[model samples]
Structure formats: C-alpha cells, structure tokens
Target: MPLAIVHQSYGRFGGAERVALAHFEQLRRMNIDATLFWSGLVTPGWQTRLKGYDIRTIPSTLPTPRNLATMIRFLRELSRYDSIIIHHHVDPLLALYLARNLGERTIWYSGSMFELAWEKWITGEDYRSISQTVKQTGQEYYGKTLSSLVLSNNVFDQTVRLARTVDIHAVRRYSKIVANSKFLSRFLKRIYKLNDTPPVVYPGPDPMLEQLSSKDFTGEGDYMLAVSPLIPLKNVDGMIQAASKVPSARLVVVGEGQDRVSLEERAGMLQVPLFLKGNCHSEEELAMLYSQCMFHIHLSLYEPFGLTPVEAGLFKKASIVTDHGGPPEIIVDGETGFIVNPRDYGMIAKRMKELLSSPELRHEMGQKARKRVLEKFTLERSAKQLLAEVES
Candidate 1:
C-alpha cells in the first residue's frame, strides 16, 4: 500500500516524533512505499535526524485564524496516498478536516486527545475538567460558544472546542483509531464516548538504541536519569522533591522546556545535585545515559505512553514511573520497576532508595525489564502491527 504518515511537527524530537519516524522507516523497509508529511518547524538538529527520509512540510495556520487555503493544500497533497495515518491531533482543525475528507483511508494513531490532556497541561487546570464538563453538559452547551472564545485567545482548550463545534466527531470520521498504550485506549473510549476500546500499538525504543546496547559502556552510576521535557506536567518539581529526600542521589535531566530555570532554582533551594542537559538530540548520548544510570525515573503527569522507560528497558535498566497514566502500563509494578503515585514524593523517594541500596535488586529488575522490552516492545513488532492494522 502507498502509505502516508501525518505528524503535526518536529518542534522537538520527542517520543511522538520518534515513533512517527520509526513507523515510516519500518514500513519502507517492509517494501511498502511510504512518505511522511509534517507541518511546522523541523529543527536543524531534527533535520539531521531525518536526513534520508521522504519527508515533506505543509503550510499550516497552527496559531493563526483557520484558513481554507491550508485545508485545500493538505487535501491536494494527502489525497494521493492509498492510506493515511495521523499521529496526534495537535492541529485539530486540520486533523478534523482531513479526517472528514479522507475518512475511509485515514487511521488516527492517537497518543491522546488535545483538549483532554494537553489543554489541561497547558492551562494547568484540574485534570479532565473539560472532558467532564462536556460529558455532563453535552457538546451543545460547551461547543456553541467556542468560536468567540477561540478568537479571543489562542489557548488550546478553545481551539479544540472550536474545531469540534464544526462537528464534534473528530475520531468518528477516521476509518480506525488506534492508541499507543492500553491506558490511552481506555482514555480515548471514555472521553470520545466510543462503545468499543481502540486497539493499542505500543511505540518502541529507538532502533538505534538496540544497536548501541552492544557497545562497551561503563558501570551504573549513583544518579538516576530522566529523559523528559523540563515542563510542569512532567513533574520535574516532584523529581527534585523526591531527590531531596534520598541522600547522595543525583538527578540528571535530558530535554529542555520553559521550566528549566524554575527546576534549577528548586533544586538549588533544596540542595539537590541536579544536572539539566538540554535536549540530547543524539540517540547514542541518550542510550549511554540509560546504560550508566542506576535506574531511570519518569514521573510525568498524564503521559500517554512513556517511551523513556521502554528505552531504559532496552539498556537493561529498570524505571520508576508514575501510576497516573501510560507509564504504569509500561512498567510491571515491583517487577520491571515500581509504579508510584506521581504526587507522593515520599513513595517515589522510597522506591529510589530501595534501588540505590541494592545493586542485586536493580540488576534483577533490569534483566526483567530488558526481557519485557524484547518480548513486547520493539520497533519491528510495532511496525508490523501498524502495517497489519492499516492493511486490514
């Protein structure tokens, strides 16, 4: 099949971008002709990463007023493919338009709905407030007034509401909707009021990480590594608070965001040794960090699918993840790693202490983690499943 993968942008080469690229690459290797369509910024660092791919950028009114020009351009280009797979709905207006126009050929591989997760994250409101409001009040009450509200501000909440105002059925237009994790599948069904749960195809670790694992790497260090954007939703403050309780436990963070300065300040105030290595664009660097760290920690709030833990697992390292969202689904509690409540710093710290105190336990859990990744989470497996779903 001629396949086209549509992703919002490569603003940061984060987990979603990595998964999208992996799917495109894997499908090509399987002899299915594929092209990737991305809109918006592709950083120079990300450009290097996407060197050999068949990637094309499209014009978008991402923040500006909705335009028919953008839709016409997208329709002309996307109509060529036999099938289309959309990664996320960050640009819901565009996404809804494409899905409506090409419903039968499109498969939405959702990480999370925009308003359900990100709007809450961006606005820092109570989790699922909008979803619950819509559920109780109905779309009639919530969506009717969205146009004027969206025009007033470029807030994500209003944008999604405005798009749904045209038609509340975003995922309904697609031929199929698949999720990245089981937790996310449930979330989609609950929020979208779908009768059946969406099928899940877990994203894999970077294929490069598997190759790098064979290299000679140093022993595990006293520090725990976090490969997350330095953002409020990632709960870096929670990580810092947890680190403060555990003596001699250094926290090293990769990936950059607006919260860098505040995270640094909090760490300083608490006298915790924190290293913020802004955006390790290289997979080798990331893999090495995973190989050397005693264990990995990802305490992100409402993370759709925690790819960091899967990456860490590839290097035979266990992770301390949150029970909030998909990370718990990635981790086998008390086996591969402990899944604690993201809010409970004491519980998070206790798990960290247990890992630090016992090299033997860490080694055992790391072994199990690697085994789990090899058995269940891999690029080959994910790509095969993706191809099967699209073809079916």
Candidate 2:
C-alpha cells in the first residue's frame, strides 16, 4: 500500500510541515512508496525543495468556507492510499469525513490539536456542519482501526471557553496516541481523559544543522537570541519588555510575520537594541547566528512543539524558554537551561542576567543542552520511530 503524508499548507516550511517533510524524505530514502499529498499552492522556495519528490496536488478550489472544495477533492482521492497520515488540517470537515469513512485505516499525525479545536469553536461550525460540497453528521472523525492520534500539546486550558471535553473526547478516541513530549503527554492524558500513555517523539534539529561544521560557527560576543515568526504568542513583545530592563542585553530576533510592525514599535518605544532579521536565507546562516549568540530565549504563551529550541540545542546554545509549555519538556530546568514563567518578563530578565553574568555557567548549560538533543532528538531516531508505527 502506498503512503500519503498530508498537510494543510506547504509553503514557507513551518515547524509542523518540516516534521512531515522530514519524514517524507526519510521514507523515500528507505525506498517506501510515499507521496507528498497536499491541496494548497506550493510557495516559490518549496517548489525547488520538492523538485524530485512525488507530489500529487488536489484540484484548486474555493477556500472561503473552510476549504470545502479541497475536502471534496481530498475525499475523491482518499480511496487510493492504504494509509493516510494526517500531518495537519486546515478544516475539521476533512476529519469528520475521514472518521465516518476511513475509520481505523488512518494515522492522525497531529502537529497541534489547538488549531482544529479552536477553529471549530469559532468559525468552522458552518464547514464542519453543513457545507455545500458534502453534508454529514456533525461528528468529529474517530474509529476502531485508527492507527494513532499524534498530538503536539494540550492547549485545552487556554481554549476552554471556546471548546469542550466532549469535543476533545470525540477527537482523542484513536487506537493509539503519540505525543511530542512527556509534559505534553501528561496534559494529553488528563485533558482527553485517556487511559493509555502516549509515546513521546521529539522532533530533531533542521537537517541543515548537520551540514554545518562546528569550527565554522562560533559566538562572537554576549548577545541573546530568539528565533520565532514575529507573532504575539511567541512573545516578541515580552522579550522586548524584558530587554528594556537589561541594559547589557542585546536581543536579535530571527523570523517575520504580521506582528513585526507592532513589535518594532514597542521596541522603538522602549529604545531596546532589538534587531529583527526577517528570515534567514538558509539554515547555514541560521545555524551561524545561533552559534554567534550567547543563548536562545523562546517565550511562547501557547507553543505545542518547539523545534527552534532543539535547533538551539544543536547549535550548542542554551535555550531559555517559558516554563509553561513544551520548552520545559526540552530544557532541563537550571541544568540544560532556565525555564521562566511566560507572563513574567521580569523573571526572564533575571534569567538573562544569571546567564549573561557568568560565562562558565553558560558554557556548562550549552554543553548539556547539546548533549541532550544528540542523545534523544534527531531525524534518524524520529523517522525510525514513525516508520515502526506506520509500517507495523
């Protein structure tokens, strides 16, 4: 049976997409007949990346009411594959269709449950309920033979008002569950009310990191780093707020999004020496920047699975992440790096001062962080685990 690695969007190589794409490449390398199945338009840079890969695009259709047209096309195309590994979804209408139709023969490769659950609670009622393309019972996809429900994190606490336990229950009833971290799996089991413990699979550093030599990349001076798609959840503003308090701290943000203007304005108002390098041209450049930094600071209010921390770990740069989410899972508190409260920029600055003042502590934490990543999280390890689950 041929394999289909599916996702909502393909352009720009986001964190979740990177996980699926890495698996895609690995599967092909192992001689598995895998296809990159997606419905959206592939952006310019991604087209070059997928040049030799087996890609099959769905019919370009309207996407106003939750990609109903694409779902129709997806439904038409589902029967051909023996297994459908859902990497991500833009619409739960597809999940509803799959549970009622495909059932146990599916693998829900969850990047995050927040997107679907939150969307359904907000604007996806019309699409999940009564779309013009296909009408069915307003039930989420669940079945007896479900291969697995892979979840990145449990964002239930933040989205409680909008979503429900019943809604979470309907979605979590898979044959097996896969979580990206132990911290997340604990949240997953509690929130979804599951009996069985899910396996934790940490995503590795970007494949580009392996190509860069350590000698070629090294830190120049005392400057903190943050790599995030300039967004509110990433807390670029929070970083700026904290940076304004620490005069010796120099923050360099790598990545861009809609939140850039607002973050820039706030930084200007505070007179923080914040440099936003929109997007790294290549992973080599990104790795070099990581190497040059004293450490990486990631403060996400609602991060599911963070690959940037792992990348920072790979770069041998200690990652100072927010205590609340996946960063705690990756960073061994006060050992690999420090984990501070997401809402406390004062504490963030304090942690920054703790590391910035001591070069010995920074080196020790950086070494430990890199060792942890090398021992546990790697593309080879992740691909092997995924293949076992999919091929079993």
Candidate 3:
C-alpha cells in the first residue's frame, strides 16, 4: 500500500520538514511507495532545498474547518493510500477529517506539544478557551472520531482532566501514535495520556555532513556556530544573551526567521559581534560553517528533535545542547557537550568558557559526539525503525 507523509506546509526547510522529507526518501529506499502531502504553498527555496519526492499541495486552512468539502474530496483521492503519518503539532483536527472518511488509517506522529506554548506566546490565551466557535468545532471533531478508533484506549481521560474538547478528538482518533523521540514518547503517555505507548523513531542525519573535514573550512574557525530559526521559542535570543556575557566569544547565527530584527538589535545593544547568516543557500555553505566553527551551540526552550547538534556532531564539532526535550537522547552531558538549564545564560556562558578556553577538551568532545551519533542515530537506522512501525 502507498504511504502518505503529511505536514501543514513546506514554506520553509526547517528541522520538522527535513524529518518529514527524510522519512519519505528513506521509506522509498526501503521499496515502499511514499508521497509527501502539504496543505499550503511550497516556497521557491523549498523547491530548491528538497528533491526526490511526489509532492502534492492542497488548499486547506486550519481552525476554520471551512474546507470540509475540500478535506472530504482530498481524503477520497487518498483512498488508495493505506495510512497517513500526520506531523501535527499535537493538534489532531486533521486526523478527525481522515477518520470521518478513512477511519482507522490515521497515524498521528506526535513530535512535541510546543503548539500549546506557541498559542500562549502568540495569543495570550490557552487553545481550549479561545472562543465558543473553536470549542464547538473541537466538540464536533471529537464526536466524529472517537467511535472510529477500536483500541480499548483511555482516549478521554487526559482530555477530560485537561478540560479541553480538542484534546479528546486529537488523542482518541489516531489508529496509531508514533513519537519522534524518547522525550516525546514520555510526553505522549503522560501529558497527552495515550493508553498505548508510542514508538520512538529518531530522525535521520544528512549524509553529506558526515564527510566534512577541516579542508572544507574557508573561513576563520574562531566563532561558535549556532543554528536556529531566530524565533522566540527557539530561544536563540538566549544564545545572544549568553554570548554577550562572554566578552571574547563571537556567535555566528545560521538561519533566518521573523525574529531577526529583534535578535540583531539585542546583539547590537549588548555590543556583541554577532554574524547573522539568514537561510543558508546550500549544503556546501552550511558544511563550511560547520567545518570552520570552533564548536556548536543550541539553546532552544522546547527543542523536539534538533538536527543542528546532530549535524554538528556529523561534522565532528563539539556541541552544547541547551534544554531538556530531545538533546538528552543525543548529547551525553559533559562528555559530548554539556546540557545546561533552558534560558540560563549564566550556565550557558560558563559551559561556553570551559570548552572555548581549552582546545583539547573541544576536540575530545567532538570526537566522542561523532561516535555517539554513529552508534545511536543515523538515516538507515531511523528508516528501518519507522518503516517497521508504519507497516505493523
């Protein structure tokens, strides 16, 4: 049977989209027919960034559920595909649409619940208490999907406790739940409260980064390389804050987003020499930055499965993963690199000093980091595990 990997959009080539694309490519290599589905327009840059897939885009908007007929028709078109792996941000409205027609063919891949925080950050209110219309929409979604699932699961307990009608539909409608990390697996069981524990299918690392060498370095290897989308939740501003405390340290922020203006202003006010490279054009350029950097640094508040640190590890660069979601699975604290408290610039500054001051320490950690990534995380391994989950 054909497989469909769905994400909201391909407007940008971020970590989540990379993972989704990686899954499509990996599964195809395993001799399964796979296609990538998106609901929004794919940016010109995305067309350049991604290759090798049958991509289909449909016009559909979330929250309004105004495209009910569109969804119904789309689901009908996808009748040939056996299942859909939803890369939802803990929002299961898509699964509800599928269950309304496709029934037990929906598998919601719960990556992280950061949407809850994003909602609070963007709008000063919880998602459940947004409006009467949204609440009614949530009720309609759950009412339709709950009966479709046959697993004797406690699909209602957590949603009832959380007091959100949306949660009830999102969690109960899925025929299967697959987590992208161990941290997310735990969050699924405890926070989302799924009766069946989701399987862990770690994201694959890009093969090109594994071949990086010092010869690739065309720039001075003096600055610390930090890759983030320069967003608030990414807490890259925290990295800027921490870099400011270390007078000698220079940070090269690689990636772009809406928060560039504020991040640049903050970097200037703090009088820190910050080099911002917005949306790297090619893998060669990204590899050059990785090969030349003294070390890698990531300090996101709620990182689901950060591929930046893993990419750094592939380039044999020592990395400090700041925060508690998926980095713990990748980095062995004080060995590969340190994991400091989220947004704690003081601790981040201290860790930065310890590694930056000592050349030997950085080299040793980078070597160990690469070794860990080889043994534990890779595209081949991730593909095999994920195929097994979806096929079963």
Candidate 4:
C-alpha cells in the first residue's frame, strides 16, 4: 500500500515547504509510493517542478473554512492510502476522525511548539475570519456545533492548555509522532506530559545552496548581509542599529515582509547605509550577495533552525547570529560564526567591526562553519534520520 502525506500547501516557498520537498524527493528516490495532499494556490513553476510526484489538491484554503467539511472530504479521499502522515501544526481532530474511520495506524509529524501556539498568538485574527465563514456555512462535521464554536477564544485557550490531552488522543489513534528537533521533542514532552519520546528529524538545507556554492564569489565584499523576512521578531531594526555604528560597512537586507516600510524609515533615522533588497528568490543572486558580504547576520528572537548561517558558511562567509533559540546550535562561537545577545546592538557592531578588520579570521571561521554543516546538517542526514524513524 502507498504512503499518503497530507500537509498544508507549499505556501510562499519558505522553510517548511523545503523540508516537505526534501522528504518527497527522498521517498521518490527510495521507490516508495508517496502522495502529497495539500490545499492552496500552487504556482505553475512549482506544479511543473513536481510533475513526477503524485499530488492531490484539497478543495479548501489553508485554515480552511468549514474545516469539518474539508476534513470529511479529506478523510474520504485519504482512505485509499494504507498509511497517512500529517506534517506540522494541522488540526489533529481531523486525524482523530480519520483514525476513527480508517483504523488507528496513521503517522503524525510535528514541527514545533511555536506553530501549535501560532494561531492563538499571531494568527488569531485570521482564525476568527475562517471561523466566521465556517459558522455561516452551518457545518457540524467534527462532532461540534459549528467550526466557529471550536475556534472561540475560550475554546482556543482550552485547546492550548489541553495540548497534552490532544496528543494522548493522537497517540491512541496514530501510529507515530515525528518531531523535527530534540529541542522541540523536549518541548512536546513537557507540554503533553508524555512518557513516549517523539522522533527528532532535522530539516535540510536549501537545494539552492548546492548550486550557489558551485560558483565563485563575484560581488564586492564591503557590505554585511541579513537575509530574512522583515518582521518584528527577526530583529532587522537591531541589525540596522548595529550597522550604524560601523559606518563604513553597508547592511544589505534580503526578503520582504509587513515591516519593510517601517524598517526603511528606522534605517533612515539611524542614518545607516541599509539597502532593502526585497525578495532575492534567485539562488544565484543570494549566493552572489553571500559570497561578497563581509558576513551574514541573523538576530531572530527565536528560530527553530536557521538555514542562512549554513548557506553563508558554504560561501566561506562568517555569520553573526543571536544567542537565543536554534542559531546557537547552528553557529560555533568565534569558530564558524559569532553569537551575540539579541538586545545588545553595541556589542554586535563591535563584533562586526572586529570581523571586518580581520580577513584571515573571517576565512578561518567561514571554513569552520562549512565543515560543521557538512559534518552534521545535510539533507541526506535529515532524510535518513526521518526514514529510519518512519521505518522504526
């Protein structure tokens, strides 16, 4: 029997999609019958790119309205596969419904605690809208009054607190729960109060990095690179303040987000030479920027696992990452890359100046960074670990 993998659509071409694609490639390579079930608008290029893969489009937007109806349709459609694997922070109630109908042996994959809490925190407004739509549709497919009733603030609070209970429900219904990192596994255990250890499968590097590293560095190496979505948590404003102290070094920020205009204004206020190059989707362009920069900077408040530092390392460029979250695990302090306090812009600028003045030191750190990634954090390693866990 073939494996059916259901996940949110590959939206905006971000980190999670990259992980899903890597899994898809690996399954194909292993000659496993794997299918992708997703819901969203897929671009033509992406569809063309995934031509060989078996893909089913669910007729609903993400955080789909009439979630119960969507789940009913999904469960009915998913009955064909012998095994089902769900990724990230999808509604587990749907999995419960599928399990009740299809027997209790489906697989469930979880990425982070951050995602489980996202709808409660950042996505509340969107969830409300989705719930309102579902309410109006008068759907009661998930043993509920309506989908809106399920997403109430009181219900959301109860849901978050009852995370452990839900996991127990999933454990009883599903075959396995696959987690992305050890950090996340610990978080799950604490949150769910579970004795069972979830499998730790790290995410892979960007495929673009492989092609990018094949070419030589071609840009003028005078600026520092900070490549991330311009969001509040990314600490782009802090990067600008740090760059201001090093007047000679330009700060080139790649990727766009809601905070771009505000960040640009902040940069102007600081009188920093901050260039916002919105969305460098092209790997060659990103590589050129990485190869030519003095170093890469990532001061995210929290990151599950940062890929940019590894990319910078591949290009023999030093990186400065925040002390918090997964970046500390990714970067080796004073070896591969520097780690700074997210709040301390002065120290960050000082470190930047120190690296800028010392070319030999930068080269050495860059080499160390590349070696670290090659040794520990590769797609092959990630795929093998995940496959091993699934098989086990």
Candidate 5:
C-alpha cells in the first residue's frame, strides 16, 4: 500500500520542509507510491519536481480555525489514506484524533522538544484561557479541542513538563513515534513513561549542500554567520554582545522573525557590528555566504539537531555552537568546531576570536567538519534509515 505523508503548511522553506522534500524524493526513487497532503500551496519548484506524484493541498488559514467543524472536516478527509505519517509541524493531538477513527496504522515524526514549548510561548496569550477551560472541563474535552502537539525546545526539564501535560495515551495509540534525535527520544521516554524503544531518526541536509561545494566565496569581509530565526530563545542579542568584544569581526544574521526589529535596535544600542541579512530563499546565495564566512555561530538555547552546523560543515566551514542538545552530536568539540555555554558571551567571543586569528586551525577544523557530515549525516543515509524503520 502507498504511504500518506501529512505535514503542516507554514512556508515552503525551512528545515522541516526540506526534510519532507528529501523523503518525498527518496520514496519516489524507490518506486513507492507516496502522496503529500499539506495545508498550504507548494512552491513552483517543488511542484515541478513532484509533477507525477499525488500531491494535495487543503486550503486553510494560517492559524487554522479552532472549531469542531474544522476538525471534523479534516478527520473525515484523512480517512482515505491507508497509513498516515505526520511530521512535527502538524498537531499531534489532531493526528491522534483522526487516526483513532481511521484505525491503528499511524506514524509521527518529532524534531525537538524546544519546538513544542516555543509554539506555546508564541501563542500563549491566545490559548491560555482556552487551555484552562478545557482542563476544567475534562481530559476528553481537552483532547478533542487542543490542536498543538509538540512543546518547547529550551530545556530538558521544560520538555518533560510539556509532555506530561499533554495526553500520552493519545500519542502512544499510534503505531510509531519517531524522534529526530537521541536526546529528544530520551526526553519522550522520561516524560511519557514509555519504554526506551522509540525510533530516533537524524535530520539530513537539503540537496543544496551538494551544489555548495562548487560555489566560490567572493564575500570580502571579516565576519561570521548566524542563520536562524531572530527569536528570544535563539539568543541573537547574545551574539551581538559577543561581536562587540571583537571590533574587527562583524556578525551577519540570515533570517526573519518577530524579534528582528528588537534585535536590530539592541545591536544599535550596544554599538555592535551586526548585519541583518533578513531572509535569503536562494540556495546559491546562502551557499556563497556560508563559503565566505570565518565560521558559523549557533547560540540556540536548546536545539534538537541543528542542520545549519551540518550545512556549514558541508561548506568546509567551522561552527561554534551551544554546548548542549544535538550540536555536540555533530561537532566534535576541538576537532570540528567549538561548543560553548549557550549564554556565555565572553566564552563565545573568545572562541570566535580564536577561530578568526588562526586560519590554519579553521581550515583543519572545517575539513574535519565536512568529513564528519559526509560519513554520517547525509540524506542518503537518513533515507535508508527511514525505509528500514518503515519496512521493519
């Protein structure tokens, strides 16, 4: 039977969408019948690539209508698929409710604990009252009404708490729950009281990494790169503070979010040499930027499996990431890159200066980083793992 891959529609870009595209391409290459159901329209490039595949889009608003009618419509439509595989972007509880009536062959993929909490934090005001009312009503009422499934990705403790608050029985009722990292798997086990047998699947880089190797860096500057949403948890302000210590070293941030304006204002107030590159959708543009950088800086408070570091590695560029979460899994400390405490600006600056001052060391570390990714974190390896798990 064919597989039905269901994912939420935010934008056609981002890490999770890239992962979905990889899976779609892999499944097609294997001659497996697969269909993609999403809420938003696919990009023209993606549509062209997926010409012969069964792709469907159900038009819905950004913040989907929180009503029983909407839920019923989705549940009724989802009944057609033989099996459902939902990505983290979709609401887990909603997937559960739909799959419950559709019968047991359902699978879920979660990227990070931080993501769940991040969503709650972002939409806390709107949902807080509703959550309270549901809690007062009953578990069944809450389960049927609440749409979000994942929690925060800030700290392990928060991740655990969020899991406990959500109904795990609804989650476990599915055939499989796939976590994107070992750390995330452990978090799920601890919170949901499940056996240590949940699948752990590492995220892979976009195919753009392959084309990056041929690109030449023509950027003439002494700056490092930080590619992530300028959110509070990402610690973009901290990167700015660290940049102040090194007058010669500028920091280029490549992403857009609600915090962009505040981050820019803070950078000005601190007199930090920070360049806000906004959002770049072109792979060639990003590759060129990555190739020219001194190194990539990722100061995420907590990440499940950071792909930017791996992408930076593909470009033979060293990275300085937070000493926690999945960054350590990719960066081999002194060998490939440096891992410092997430909020320590002094330490971050020290490491940045160390890399900037020593060209040979940077080159050596960059080479090691590239070697590590090629050996373990490629999309081909990830696809093989996914197929093995599904077939098993």
Candidate 6:
C-alpha cells in the first residue's frame, strides 16, 4: 500500500512545508512508497527543488454547497491511498472534510491553530469561551448552533467558531493526531478534551544543514543572527533593544515582513547597528550566517515549534529563545541555550552579555547544542517515529 503525505501549499513557505518536504525525501531514501499531495501554486524558488517528485495538486478552492460533486471526487481520490498524513494550517475546511470522511485512514499532523490563535491575539478576546462551548456542548449542539451563539458580526468570534468546529468535530475523530510540540499538544488536549496528549513529532532542519561541515571560528562572531519574519508577533524590536545594550554585538535579521520599516526606524532611533537580509531561502546563505554568528535569538510570541533554533543547533550555534513556546523544550537552559521572557529585553541582553563575554562557554554550549540536535532532532529520527506511528 502506498503512503500519502498531504500539505496545504507551497505558495507561502514556512517551517511546516520544509518539514513535509524533508519527511518525503527521507522516506523515499529509505525506499518506502510515498506520494505527496498538495494544493496551491508552487512559488518560484521551490520549483527547481521539487522537480522530480510524485506531487499531485488538489483544487485551490474548497467545495461549496453547490460543488458537492467536486468534494465527492476528491474524497474518492484520497481513499485510494493506504494511509494519509494531512498537514493542517492553510486549509482547515479541507482537513475537516477529510477527517469526517476518512477518519480511519487519516493521521492529522497539526502545526498550529493559527485561525483562533491570531483571532485571540487581534481581538484581545478569551479563547477559553470557544473552548468551553466545544467541550461542554459537544459537536452536535456547537456545530449547528455556533453561529447564533457567537457574535455573527465579529470577525474574530466567527473565526473562533469555525476553528472550534473543526477541533471538536473533525480533529478528534482521526485515527491518530500528531502535534509539532508539547506546547501545542497541551493546547490541543485542552480544546479537544482528549484523554491523552497527542504525540509530538519535532521538526528537524533540512538535511543539507546537517551535512554541512562545521566551520571553526577563531573567536566568537561579532553579530547575533535571527531568522524570522519581521513582524510584531516575532518581536524583532526586542532583538533591537537587546542589541542596543551590547555595544560589541551587532544584530542581523534574515527574514522580511510588514514590520520591516518600523523595525528599521526603531533600530535607527536606538542607534543600534541592525542589518536586515530579506527572505533568504538558500540553505548555503543561511548556513554561512548560522556558522559565523555569535549566537541565535528567537523571541516570537507563542512560537509553535521554533525550527530556527534547531537549524542553529545543526550549525553548532547556541540560541536564546522565548520561554513561552516550544524552544524551552529544545534548548537546555544554562547549558545548550537560555530561555527568557519574550517581553523582557533586559533579561535577553543579560543573557547575551554572558555569551559575549565567554568564548569558551559559547563554543562549549554550541558543541553540546549540536550533539543534542543530532540525538533528538534529525530528519531520520523524526521520519522513523512518524512512520512508526502510522504503521501502528
């Protein structure tokens, strides 16, 4: 029986797509029969990379009330596969439909509940209300009456309802559920009221990252490297603030988003030397940055799995990450790296000072970080665990 790996899209590439592609490659290298099914148009840079893979495209738009035939055909096509691993994020409605129809053969790999998470962040509303409804009312009552119960005109509330609908009705019914991190698994358990936590399959860096030979720097690099979209949620400003306190350490940010202008302006006001390298998709360029950096910093608000830290680890670099998210699980405090409160720039700076002052400590921590990554976060390890779950 052939295995099928389903991902939402490659149009807006991020950690999830990277993990999916890595898993597909690893499985095929192991000589397993696997085909990848995805939706949305492939972005330009990824076209060359995905040249010779058995990838099939699903229709971009979800089936509506008038498009019942399209939904039937798609489901029938899906049923042909022995088992399906669906990556959720871009298309919850499709995930919902697939779980409802093919629950027995499906394993839902949840990366994030961003629909409700972003809504709560935007509206400053309590997510627990929706969780309560889903938990107490169960699927039947909430599925039919959620529209009336939630504020119809409020966009955030509407999103919460739809997200909860999928959580209660669709996600829990799958044969198995895998979360990207323990942080996310706890959140899923709370919302779905599951008897046990969903298994966590930590994502690894691209295989190329692991294969690159480690460069031995004579001394610590002058700049601190950060690789994330320059958005408010990512807290690029926090890095700027932290860098301002440390005169010797410059800050280099590698990804771009809406907050770029503001971050640049803020860095200018603070008189901090900040270099912004926009959207670097090339592994070689990223590897150089990672190899020559003093250390990595990621302080995203409630980051899901934090693949950048893992990527940094592969390059033999320690990191300082937010305590609120999954990085705490990856980095061992006082050893591999430090986890600090995202909002506390003072604490971040303090940690940075500690690393900057001691080259011996930094190199030792980096070596340990690389060892940890090899033991825990590797494509081979993650793929084998995922395959074991599917086969069981």
TM-score for each of the candidates: 0.87, 0.80, 0.82, 0.80, 0.82, 0.87
**Candidate 6, superposed: residue stretches over 4 Å from native:** 41-46, 64-68, 88-90, 117-154, 213-220
Question: For candidate 1, lDDT tens digit of each residue in 1-392?
Answer: 67888886424557887777777777788888999887654545557867887888755543334646665776878898999999764456666777678888989888777654335434466333323222322222224354334434357466555555643465777888899889889877876778789999998876878889767898777789999887677888999999899999899999887678889999999999999988786777877898999999999766788899999998889899988788887789999999999999999999999999999999999999999999999999999998888888
Over 173-199, each residue of candidate 5 has an lDDT whose tens digit, in order, gives: 767778888877877666567775578
Estimate the overall C-alpha local distance difference test score of candidate 5: 0.71
The lDDT values for all models are 0.78, 0.68, 0.71, 0.70, 0.71, 0.77
Q: Report the candidate with higher TM-score, 1 versus 3.
A: 1
lDDT of 3 at 167: 54
Clashing pairs in 1: none
Considering every candidate listed, which one attains the maximal lDDT? 1
Candidate 3 weakest lDDT stretch, 10 residues: 144-153
Task: Indicate the TM-score of model 6.
Answer: 0.87
Residue-level lDDT of model 6, residues 229-312, one tens digit each, is 765667888889888888776899997666778889999999998999997766677788898898999997667788999999
> Residue-wise lDDT of candidate 4 within 1-392, one digit each (tens)?
47777765323445565567667766777777888876543445456668867788654422446765776777787887877777654444554565577645477666654333343443343333322123332233233454455557668666554644554565556677777766666656765567788877777675557667768676547888998877666789899888888868788998776677888998899888888998665557777888888889999766666768877877877899998667777788888878999879999989999898888888889888888877887777877776676667
lDDT of 3 by residue, 6-86 (tens): 876323456776666666766777888888776543435456646656788753534446676676677787787988778
TM-score result, candidate 4: 0.80
Give the root-mean-square deviation of each candidate in angstroms. Answer: 5.7, 8.1, 7.3, 5.2, 6.4, 6.1
- TM-score preference between candidates 3 and 6, better one: 6
Off by over 4 Å in 4: 9-11, 41-45, 61-70, 91-103, 114-174
The digit string of per-residue lDDT tens for model 2 on 1-392 reads 68777765522446776667677877788888888876553435556777898887643333345566666667767768887777644345455466556646667655566443453433334222212111111111222222022121243343333335434543554445567767667766776677776677677665657556265754455688998877556778898898888887889998776677888889899998888888776656777888889999998776667888888888777888987667787889999998888779889889888888888988899899988988988887887787677767
Task: Report the alpha-carbon TM-score of model 2 versus the true structure.
Answer: 0.80
**Any runs in candidate 5 off by more than 4 Å, and if so which?**
10-12, 41-48, 59-82, 113-167, 217-221
